[model samples]
Target: MTVRTTDTPVRVMIVDDHEVVRRGIVTVIDASPALTVVGEASTVDEARRRLPAVRPDVLVVDLQLPDGTGIDVMTRARELSPEQRMLVLTSFDDDAALRESRAVGAAGMLLKSARSRDIVAAIEKIAEGQTVWPSRPAEDEEELSATDQRIVELIGDGCTNREIADELGIAEKTVKNRITAILHSLGLQRRTQVAAREAARRRAGWK
Candidate 1:
């Protein structure tokens, strides 16, 4: 939860690569009495350039873009205006992306799969400085989940995807999918890196 420091109409920016999608969001915001569309961007560079000038209270952004990502935009936006609340409005609902959003300090996240009304409501809530969505599970100590440890253990043991699958009694594809997810959770690029980090942790007496 948060509290707004300003009394102005909720100034909003929409950053989506799709023109139709941007226009549609603008239409919805324009209809709302408490909200106003201050600016719009279809690319990360454009959004980066325009975001500060507009000084929006809330930023509604898509995940993917031609030049960069909404996460990239928000990362820069946070540096410029840390007080501004950002709402992730994207088609992606995966845990990794959500975790990344939380890492970068987005106020909330909503999927494109959500209803138009629900999207608007999320925007309104964020604009009002209220957290509106469930955040990714992040603990103070970055407590790794049991599944994360299993993946790390297999990776550290130099187990291939098939090997991990056989050991865990799951399909190889499932192991591969979980590896991708584990990489995201750990903010790593490859499975080998997960293995390296997990080995270091074990060396430090972490089970």
Candidate 2:
């Protein structure tokens, strides 16, 4: 992809199993005046190898990889540079990954279906030391069952009910039921509230 920018581009590393997805993201990166694609990787191994060389300011990583989970890459990146900004891009918006990513120091998480502008905006925000999350919030962990927790994660990751159901291999109706229970238990008006709560908890280092 060609980079078209005059701003001090936020150097980025793209990690995903799909070549076309990576290229598309690269195209977005290249088109953004504030971002640049420094490197791309199809798996954890390649990411590990190329990361040190690229030493990008931000990493746009997919949660699922052929060889290993993106968390492996996150850990490696942390070891290399604790300050490196990591933004997750995934099809499964599992709440567990969202919490884990935050606990492990990811700056942001976005769904694969997020608009190109939204993706670039997230990259820029992360580079500027700000966190960006999906509009839907996660439910309180204490108030959710294992299944509910999974649903919340997906919601926080920006997945629709159908997407969440597909990811968890459950019925969409089940997801709806779990969400209803979660709201009642947590006394939260909207899912975004859960996201806000999680964000605050992460900031306070309240695992």
lDDT of 1 by residue, 1-207 (tens): 457767677889999999988898898888888788999999989999997799888999898889767778888888997777999998867565565666677888888777778877888888777876655444623445566568678789889999888998866755665666566666788777888897897899875
TM-score of structure candidate 1: 0.68
Report the C-alpha lDDT of model 2 over 91-203, residue by residue, as the tens digit.
Answer: 87766566556655688899988899999898988888889876544444544457766666677677898998899986675465456556655667687886676566557
Candidate 2 global lDDT: 0.79
**CA displacement after TM-score superposition, residue 105 of candidate 1 (Å):** 0.8
TM-score of each: 0.68, 0.66
Estimate every model's Cα lDDT from 0 to 1: 0.79, 0.79
User: Where does the lowest 10-residue lDDT sum fall in candidate 1?
Assistant: 135-144
Name model 2 segments beyond 4 Å from true: 1-7, 135-207
Relative to the true structure, candidate 2 reaches a TM of 0.66
Best by TM-score: 1
* lDDT (Cα, 0-100) at 186 in candidate 1: 69
- List the candidate 1 regions with Cα displacement exceeding 4 Å: 5-7, 134-197, 200-207
